[model samples]
Target: MTQTAEAAAENLPARRESRAEKLLSWLIRGASPAASHLLLLPAAAWLLVFLLLPVACLLALSLATRGPYGTVVWSFTWANFGRALNPMYLPVLLRTAAYAGSATGLCLALGFPLAYYLSFYAGKRRETLLVMLMIPFWTSCLVAIYSWMIILGRHGLLNDLLGRLGLIQAPLPLLNNGFSVVLGLVYFYIPFMVLPLYGSLEKIPRAYLEAAYDLGASPAEAFLKVTLPLSLPGVFAGCLLTFVPCMGDFLTAEFLGGPRNFLIGNLIQNQFLMSQDWPFGAALTALLVLSLISGLYFYQRLEARQIEP
Candidate 1:
């Protein structure tokens, strides 16, 4: 009877331990799904609060009317959107598109070679080059744009250099023109273009090139067929990065471009700050956002098709 009682005492501890382990296991199992959702909640909430809410408000404002006192009126109206489509605004939109498109093309032309060199030929200096590329971003964009103003102004560095070199009789009208605006846009956005191209180019295996060479393909052929096709994703990404921001860049046009070179960004800014037409400005903003989203959707579909076997 004593031995039997001792065995029962030993079994009680084991049973308790088993129950504790089961409880822990069940807790972990049940909490895993909830924990994953909990982890996503902050990001979802941030998007909802910041991005979606502001866009919704902007959309609502776009649909409403502007009051005489430069305030938003809650009445429904399509006049704002209709005004945005007028012939006066079409030229601004076209010019904006032209500048952005030119910048994107120039970025691709300049950045692709640099990225290709960095990926294939930089060797141990790759990191240094990348660091140098990123150095411009360390400073404020406004400061950089202002610095360009100094360099490109009539009496500024370029003019002084030209004078010393006897290149021209007078300081060229370099600043406050379309040329300067495009140059500023290119300078500011080139790094964005390069990084994505580098990412794509670096991922192309050397073995693929070697295999192509073994099959009697020249370097140009290999690049044209293999490298270019594989790198389309990066090219599209770079274009989107460069183009979207360039389209909406008011500061570059404001400082570098004169009154004649104003783009959609400047127009929008004027509507809001100078004209105080909140409804029209909101309509313009909504249109720009929707257009960009539509372009992105089409690009994404194209990318998916390109990636498919």
Candidate 2:
């Protein structure tokens, strides 16, 4: 009798909470469509003031002309766009694409196995492993990049270890190159790839795998046919996440790649900051945004085709 009373007392607050939630939900459902629209006004207004305003300003700036003294003039011209698209800037754009693509590929290769292991084989330790994977995000990105510099620098950890092992007479040229830039990008963005892949992989029902096995399909064949196809959405999302930022990353290239491996991002940064050419920088930014939008459109088309009956 005492235990039953205790149980009732314990559930009383939960019951009250459930009733309160039901009441709130009922109130919301009873709200008029005009009221519902009013609720979204704040968000819409926020986007307009913050997002749309800035973008409009940038577009205006991109269309405007730069003065002789580096001031932005209200006069309109397409020269900035033409200069950004010219042959002289083609190499920078191409290099940006190449670096971003390389980093995306490397991240996919590394993240897939990690995600696969976490989803399938991690068993009881999945949460712990995930925490470890996310630990890097707890600190500043600048600190993480600086740590890589310490590891890859001429007198840094790797060179010291290699020297100790009698690997070579001189410190290897590990830093200030394309390799370091890509390495930094992969290190920074691998989590973005892994998390999406794990989300998709984990959602795949175990029963499907069991059914495949019951149909006399080998593990390799089953994975190739079922798991890979099911995980393509995650792969696409991960690649998109990694590649887009890499294309606009000036810090990684500036710190690790130096002058010779200049990507479009560095060029944009130079124009905006060093050269004080706001119009040209805005034009380049617009071009980058357009390219990304085109890629997104293609991705949507591909996704839609895959979903077609």
lDDT of 2 at 103: 97
TM-scores for all predictions: 0.88, 0.88
**Candidate 2: C-alpha lDDT:** 0.90
lDDT of 2 by residue, 1-309 (tens): 999999999899999999999866765785676656666789999999999999889988999889887799987899999999999997889888998999999999999999999999999999999999999956688998899999999999999999999997899999999899999999888998999999999989989999999999999999998899888888888888888998889888888887799888888888888899999999998988888889889887887776563
lDDT of residue 246 for candidate 1: 91
Best-fitting candidate, measured by lDDT? 1
Indicate the residue-level lDDT of 108 in model 2. Answer: 100
Model 1 TM-score is: 0.88
The runs of at least 3 residues in candidate 2 whose Cα sits more than 4 Å from the true structure, single-residue gaps closed, are 1-30
**Residue by residue across 1-309, what tens digits does model 1's lDDT show?**
999999999999999999999976765666677756666789999999999999899999998998897988898888988999899787888888899999999999999999999999999999999999999967799999999989999999999999999999988999988899999999999998999999999899999999999999999999999999989889989989998999889999998998899988888899889999989999988878877788889889988898884
| Position 177, candidate 1: lDDT | 85
| lDDT agreement of model 1 with the native | 0.91
